[model samples]
Target: MSHSGILTLLTDFGLSDPYVGVMKGIIAQVNRSLTVIDLTHHIPPQNIHLARFALMTAIPYFPARTVHVAVVDPGVGSDRRPVAVALGSDPNAPMGFLVGPDNGLFSGVLSQYPALEAVELTESQYWWTATPSSTFHGRDIFAPVGAHLASGVPLQKLGTTIAVDSLVMLHSLTPQRTKHTLTGCIQAVDHFGNLVTNIPASEVNGQTWYAVVKDVTVLGRKTYSDSAPGELLAFVGSHSWVEIAVNQGNAQSVLNLGIGDAVQVILNQPHSSQGD
Candidate 1:
């Protein structure tokens, strides 16, 4: 089911602006036959942590060889390197291309797919222009480069090879597990205001769990129905993380939470103290 010659774009640039459209236009100009999928255009501006989590969750569903262009760059005009990463090309691995700035926006997906090959986009010829706008690398660099990659241009030819370890990775909050408590940080806030924690859902599988955020102890539930309407509850989200949500309500508003907010998850009884 791998869709070749397909490119997926994710950006903090909302639909109101022409930025996302312009990037698509550049991609189309480079390769008219390629299919461009708009993964999303509504990522909160400058929210790299949320961008990372979104990419991580969505990439597993895309077919192999789809190029992913993510632009949540806060350092667009700075000296940050523009990068294109080829990941998970092995037999049973998830294969895709990640195109964006060298910031940690790609880190979440990289944790799962480990880089097969990565390059700094130094070849100006592949970009839309020789003198790209310092502020908008999305249109000038990432768009065209991703289009070229999806159009079958080789990865190495795009730019200089760099060590996978050298790539910038965010020191995002990793969940710490004790016998009965998991301490982590919120990594994303969904449209419904459900707070997604860095803690993996598997940790509390088949066990009772509750979450404490902003000093409120939320009851654990198997689903939203476990709580009354507008009541905040915690549950394992369908993806990979634990989510704190209020049934038919905005948890973000109730908790006054945002990304990086501290989260304490209390689970019942003993599990092996692996991450302690």
Candidate 2:
């Protein structure tokens, strides 16, 4: 079969390096007609969780059969295995592909879809050049392999089949819930300074609540304008997660909150009216 799906790239190798570019070059060399999109090239160094979250958010936006290649391997030079995964719960949908280290970066994606197919990438000579480098497999190995796969190569030809249980999984953000209270932690801080938390919108519906962070209670608002510009407000975010943001300011800096900080949603009525 001829290759016809989109190939997407995600990595912590910032644009300053020739790493990402070289990978693309290798892919183009294998299949010139393949379309490539750069999801991001600025993930924090070795921040696998951030990479996983970024991948999950971008995958749904692409058309079916989109091949996603991610490389955030801190253990690149180590004994870790490179992998290619096809994600989909329904057997009929065009399966999504992931080419990267066998680290826990695929955790979030696998969590949302349990029946994903996984395989270890073992084809060596078929890589970009005759000899591959230990430190930069993204260019030598993953890129070429992904391009070839996108070009209609059967996944089984890449390597031997493996059970999903054998793959690595990262620990995702967990939200704790009580009678009416929900507690979660900040998972990441985006470029716009918004603190993305683990609390989902389903946890706070039909209830009045306060987002308590570092002892400061941020009032829940229906929208950003419900508060003065640059003032902090808590609202249900685009991903169905409750977010702490400022209309035109950076909530991460303004509130001095960082990842793993404790955030609580107290569902009880505001304290001021309790005595009335």
Candidate 3:
């Protein structure tokens, strides 16, 4: 494994604490020349679901071989395994490394990229220290392993090879489609209080659609602006997921919708008979 020169860190550890900084320092100590990027540190504390979504969305834009370190572990100091896994398979597919605990945090990325190889981080030499703290493996284990991976350490050298199937996984809600409706659930509420659904934008491509949930319905539009203040607007976010927002209000506060809340998308245009 040659050094990729780029590494990204994603964690629920907020900037208010020194945890994020310490992890970065560990990585920097391993490879001084590597460019380190922060994916996000404000992940809402133990909110691994959003962390998964964030990484899955951000991974596509990174260059191949860029090592990604995600430390959203709520199971620290437990029996949970610290692991690093390589993802993607196609020769032209965008593939990279995911170093973190074997929690559901990396499952969203796995849904997008096939797991090529995986290993349990049992080797102490590749870790930050041989006597790692029971807590804060993000600083003790994951950070350094990711740094070593970016510093040209082979995946196999860092830990014992393990079956990808043995790794824990996360299952996101799958959107369902009928001739005139799309059934999905709210996946997350973003910083701006946008209600993000699992429905893909392509589900409404070339058709008119409206989103309904919790007795509130909103028109589908290209943007959530230009509407009257406090009016709801449903649109496709930059991440390509259907999102509901208010013109000048907080959708989460206004709509009172949250993760796992059911969202029904009603198609207004004529239904195509070709696929029916």
Give all candidates' CA lDDT scores: 0.88, 0.81, 0.86
Please, what is the TM-score per model?
0.93, 0.91, 0.93
Show pairs that collide, candidate 3.
Answer: none
Per-residue alpha-carbon lDDT of candidate 2 for residues 98-185, written as tens digits (9 for 90 to 100): 8888898877677776636777877775577657787888998889989988888777788878897888987655888898678899
Over the stretch 1-276, how does candidate 3's per-residue lDDT look in tens digits? 354689999998889889988998898899889999999999998998888888989998988889999999899989988998988784333278999999898888888789988989999988888999988899999999999988778788888899998888878779888888999998878899998899998898777888878766677888856467878888899999999898888989986778889998889754322211
- Sorted by lDDT (best first), the order is 1, 3, 2
Q: Among these predicted structures, which one has the highest lDDT? A: 1
> Lowest summed-lDDT stretch of 10 residues in model 3?
267-276
Q: Cα deviation in Å at residue 124, candidate 2?
A: 1.5
Query: Model 2 — which ten-residue stretch has the worst lDDT?
Result: 267-276
TM-score of 1: 0.93
Judging by lDDT, tell me the better candidate of 1 and 2: 1
